[model samples]
Target: MTAIAIDHDKPDLTGDTETQNDIFLQVFNSGDGALFDRLYRDDAISNFSGEPLTGEARRKFFVEFIGAKPVLEARVTHSYVAGDVALIGVDFSVKGTGPDGQPFTIEGKCTDVLRRVEDGRWLMAVDRPVAAGGLLPE
Candidate 1:
């Protein structure tokens, strides 16, 4: 496992599975779209909007999401690793003001898959959030 990068310019994602979530939070909270993009692979999949999206669709969603400046807090619940692949479960909430200028909060359990790339860095392969049983207070 590599040390976490202090400079956000180029984050080091070679830590253990659990540490990956922490690093993710650090980057996500930074709101740097370009740096956030480095956390995933070229073909990564994300269902941040409750719909599985990849390619341009995913890019668009994230562009708006980062632009929104949402605040995300997450705790890793569990993680499993086998060789180069890792599965991580996280309980999280994203709070922010929507485009309508309404304050909103979304809570969910996220299932993430990460793979150790050729450079020995762990990058997210998949990210899917399962909605919580009840909606957050409006």
Candidate 2:
């Protein structure tokens, strides 16, 4: 079966990380990994598992992560922009059923670094979600 793509009519990724946050949530909830990946750079890093993951590892992780059919909620806590770069802080939660058929929920805050490419589109360079105490194993 073929799937049809929908145009959300949202603005293109620009200098507004605030609006991008909303777009991120929408794409995430849609569970379209290919579309979701467009929000990040080719070499982007995601610390979702408490370890920095990039390259094919990151793509594989995201594929599994999205396969859980997780639902996400994110709120932009703070954002700062300088030149072609931006840093955004977000509080978020995700709930879904694991591959083992167990229900799981994760709530945390994330720090994201974004950069505007030559085409004037902002993409995440780093995405690191931290626990409440801001601690991760060394």
Candidate 2 is scored at a TM of 0.84
Backbone clashes (count) for model 2: 0
On residues 30-116, what C-alpha lDDT tens digit does candidate 2 reach at each position?
776666666678898878766888878877777778756799888899999999989999999888898898998888888999998
Which has the greatest lDDT? 1
Local error of candidate 1 at residue 55 (angstroms): 2.5
Which segments of candidate 1 are over 4 A away from where they belong?
1-11, 133-138
Q: Residue 47, candidate 2: how far off, in angstroms?
A: 0.9
- Candidate 1 has a TM-score of 0.85
Q: Using TM-score as the measure, which candidate wins? A: 1
